[model samples]
Target: MLKYKLVSRANPRKRNEKQFYAQLTGVQTIKRCDFLSLLEKRSSMSSADVKSFLDALEFELMHRLANGISIRLGDLGSFRATIRSVGAVNKKDYDQRKYIKGVNVRFRPSAKWMREKSKTGELISFETVGKA
Candidate 1:
């Protein structure tokens, strides 16, 4: 049986406006160690111990990513730099649109994850679908 739940926050704009919003919900597991139990033998450790270790590891990762360094987790993924816009753009200067100040963050994922995903199915052409 799956012990953990997948949780997420709703997009504020979608609330109470659509039927799908009711269906869309986030279910996060109680803690990371709860997930760790699935991959390894954890009979010796308590949940609190596992949680503390995982939390420390996550903090270290965020620290490294903030310094423009990528953290590679085996069989998971790699975290790399990404840019985001900060300030508002002036409508008159179209040429300046490409230049925007932003921050850096790391992304993590490994090839094994991709391989597992590929076995699910092949992509279908959008045109093949009939209109409702």
Candidate 2:
């Protein structure tokens, strides 16, 4: 279950009006070690082995992304790297060195994953806990 509280704040861009939204009462964080322990029981590999495997996977993912490649993760999703650049006046003036502004990574989930997540029969609930 997800618990949240309604929060009211003055609209910075608008005058004499307040904006309301639901904010999470608390957040739970899961760490690498905790995840490794859970994975260890589900796999034949030990925690240390799982940790090493995850490290290698992350390294390879970053390496491939840096080389302008997209990697597919079967049913989970795929990761892609993209860059945004400033506009140039002409084709002759368009140079990556001067026009490139930022680089970012994007993930797209698979259709199966999205379909399963959209099913209302799944055991998921949201609770409102008043104001924050």
Candidate 3:
């Protein structure tokens, strides 16, 4: 379940006009150690083993992404490095310092994640927790 609060936000175009919207409130974050411990219990491997594997996986992902490779991680998702830059008229006129801003990783959720249904409503449900 997700907890949300009603927030009054002003419109960017019209600052005087405001409307209420649901904003995510107090989302809990699971740290690396805590997540590793949970994974350790679910698998036969120890926490240290899981941590080592995760470290190696991170390295591999970074290396592959830097080399313009998109990786599909089973049912979880696929990740690819995307360029956030300005357009250039010609390839020869394109300059990395001016045209290329930065690179960002993009994740596309799997079909299972996109279209999961449960007996109780949806896979994820939200609850209102008053105004913000």
Identify the leading candidate in terms of TM-score: 3
lDDT-superior candidate, 2 or 3: 3
lDDT per residue for candidate 1 within 1-132, as digits (tens), equals: 212323344557886443221122233556455586642364566666666777788898878877778888887789876767655467566443565566666564577766664444332111212221
Q: Estimate each model's TM-score.
A: 0.46, 0.71, 0.77
Better of 2 and 3 by TM-score: 3
lDDT of 2 at 98: 91
lDDT of 3 at 68: 100
- Write the residue-wise lDDT of candidate 3 on 21-114 in tens digits: 8988889999988988998999999888999998999999999999999999987789999999999999999999999899999999888776
Give residue 4's error in model 1 in angstroms: 21
Better of 1 and 2 by TM-score: 2
CA lDDT, every model vs. true structure: 0.57, 0.87, 0.89
- Tens digit of lDDT per residue, candidate 2, span 14-59? 9579998878876688998898899999999988899999999999
Candidate ranking (lDDT, best to worst): 3, 2, 1
What's the TM for model 3?
0.77
Report the error of model 3 at residue 41, Å. Answer: 0.9
Candidate RMSDs in order:
10.6, 3.6, 3.1
